[model samples]
Target: MEALRVIVDPPAADGGRRVWVGHETVGLAYCRADVLDFLRRAGLDPERVRLEDAEQIEWHGGGPGSWGARE
Candidate 1:
C-alpha cells in the first residue's frame, strides 16, 4: 500500500491550518484534534498517514513566493 502523506501548511486565509493530501486540499483544521477528525471523515486512517511539516516539502508549484520555494 502506498503511504499517504498529510502535509500541514501554515495558516491560510481562513486563519486555520491547511491540510494537504497529495496536492489536494483536504480541509482546514484549527488544531490537532480537528485535523484527526478531518482525516477520519475523509476515510483515511490518521495513524497511517505520514504527517509532514510544510517546510520540509519541496514546492512543486514553481513560482515566486511559493511555499518551500528554493531561492
Candidate 2:
C-alpha cells in the first residue's frame, strides 16, 4: 500500500497552533476524518501531527530474487 502526507494545524478556537508534517505546513480542514478519529480516541489532538513521508517507497517483493526461489 502507498501513503501520502498532509500537514495539519489546530483550529482557531483551540489556540490555532502551527503544526508540521515533516516540515511542511497544512490547514486543519485538510486533515482526514479517520485520522482525527484515531487521534481523539488516543487522546491526541490531530492538529499537531505530522504525516509520514508523502512519497511512497517502491515495493520490491514482486521482483525476481525477492521470493528466494531458485531459477
Candidate 3:
C-alpha cells in the first residue's frame, strides 16, 4: 500500500495547525511532536508518511516542506 501523504500546514489565521491525508483533514496539531503523535494514534507510521508544507505545496508543486515543527 502507498504510504499516507501527510500535509502539515503552518498555523492558520486562527492559530490552529492542520494535517491532511489526501483531501481529508485528519486533525489539528500545535507542534511537530503532536503531529507525529496524532499520526501514530491514527494507526499510521509517522516515518512512512510524507510531510509537506502548505505554503510550499501551494507555490512549489508540493515539494517536501518542514516537518510540521513550528519554526
Candidate 4:
C-alpha cells in the first residue's frame, strides 16, 4: 500500500489542531491520543503508526510537545 500523508495543522485558538489524511481532513485533535484516534478511525493501525516519525506525520507550527500558545 502507499504511504499515508498525514498533516497536523497548527494549534487553533482553542488549542485544537486539524488533522489531515491525504486530501481529507479527519478532524481536530486536542492531544496525541486524539490524533491516534483519527488515524484508527481512518482504518490505520495506531500501534503501527509513529507520531514522531516525520515521514509519517507532518506536524506544522510545533510537534506533539506543542499544544497551545501558552505552552
Judging by TM-score against the true structure, name the best candidate.
Answer: 4
Candidates, ranked, lDDT: 4, 3, 1, 2
Error of 3 at 27 (Å): 1.0
**Candidate 4 collision pairs:** none
- Number of backbone clashes in candidate 3: 0
Tens-digit lDDT string for candidate 1 (4-54): 565666655544666666668788666556677777776787676433444
Candidate 2, residues 1-71: lDDT per residue as tens digits? 32333333333343232333334433232223544554444444556543342331111222111222222
- Which 10-residue span in candidate 2 carries the lowest summed lDDT? 56-65
- Flag regions of model 2 displaced more than 4 Å: 1-31, 53-71
Task: Point out the higher-scoring one by TM-score: 3 or 4.
Answer: 4
The models' CA-based lDDT, in order, is: 0.55, 0.34, 0.56, 0.92
**Across residues 1-70, which tens digit of lDDT does each residue of candidate 3 receive?**
6545566666655544776765777687665566777677767777864445443223122233332334
**Tens-digit lDDT track for model 4 on 28-64?**
9999999999999998999999899998999998998
Mark the 10 consecutive residues where model 3 has the least summed lDDT: 55-64
Model 3 residue pairs with clashes: none
TM-score for candidate 1: 0.55
The alpha-carbon lDDT assigned to residue 1 of candidate 3 equals 68
TM-score of 3: 0.54
The top-ranked prediction according to lDDT is 4
